[model samples]
Target: MPSPVGHALGGAIAAVLIAPRGTPTGSGSRLMALRARLSHPLVRLGALAGCLPDADFLWGRHNMETHSVGAALAAALVAGLALRSRRAALVTGLAWLTHVAFDWLGSDDTPPLGVMALWPFDDRFVFAHAYLFEAISRRYWLPNFVTHNAWAVTSEVLMLAPILAVLVWWRQRGAGPRV
Candidate 1:
């Protein structure tokens, strides 16, 4: 899977794109006109969601069931219930799913490759095999591992920078007009 840096960056990028900055002129629905008042906090919260799936590592295994798309949706639903906002569900669920997507596209050199992304239903491990992201090596948390992760972080930043920029531009462009 890609580093948390990549996943959090992806979540930040998604937050900028999905968050409603302001109510557009003459918008009808209340939800459509919403300013997303707590958008700033939600932004950080959404980014945090990207890292939550890895919490599964504390229990038994990594990526077996926690990385599932169904799990992501369940998380979103729980987030909505907890926060009392559908928008919360939307942003968080998608952000969490982005982690799984990154893991899918990332390089995995260890045995029993890929994650059970479709768990509880299909129970099949899947991967993109395109290696758009470098796998994060946490097997060793030593100084050498820091250097190794540094390289991975550099690569991730280089690749994800443009997407983040585009999402920022998109958010700024849509901040005023919804048309």
Candidate 2:
């Protein structure tokens, strides 16, 4: 499964694409606009949501209940009620689901491999077996731990940076206007 870094990037991307936008104001250079979007509370919340499913680790259940559509919907409902914005709710829920997506596409080295993505409706675990992202290691004492994780993080950055750049460019070119 992807690390928090990758998951956060995915969530931020979802937020940028789906969250409702305010009217563009001031100097609308790409950098400024991108900065503004990145700094929005919704983006930050999305990033948080992206990493939220990992909280299952605290209970020694990393890919169980929290990594499910049910959890995503609950998160959306709570965010919607709290923010009073349907767009925010949708963005937040999708952002949370991005965690599940990353995990589904990643390599899983643990037992009962894959995530319980459809929980509440079904308890079956699922995985794409795509291996698009590397599995993260919790074994700090392993010889290649640091090196492996570093490479994993680098790979994630390389994969995600281009997409983020394109999205920012599209927004700047008015192809994706703030809505």
RMSD of each: 5.9, 1.9
Deviation (Å) of 67 in candidate 1: 0.3
Writing each residue's lDDT as its tens digit, candidate 1 over 30-112 gives: 54433332236666777888878888889977877888888889989998999998777887888888888888888998756
Clashing pairs in 1: none
What lDDT score belongs to each candidate, Candidate 1 first?
Answer: 0.76, 0.86
What is the alpha-carbon lDDT of model 1 when measured against the actual structure? Answer: 0.76
Q: Write the per-residue lDDT of candidate 2 for residues 60-151, one digit (tens) a residue.
A: 98899999999999999998999998878987899999999999999999978899999989989999999999999989999999999999
- The clash count of every prediction, one per candidate, is 0, 0
Residue-level error in angstroms, candidate 2, position 95: 0.4
Give the winner by TM-score. 2
Candidate 2 lDDT (Cα, 0 to 1): 0.86
Segments in model 2 whose C-alpha atoms lie over 4 Å from true places: 21-23, 176-179
Candidate topping lDDT: 2
Shift of residue 89 alpha carbon in model 2, Å: 0.4
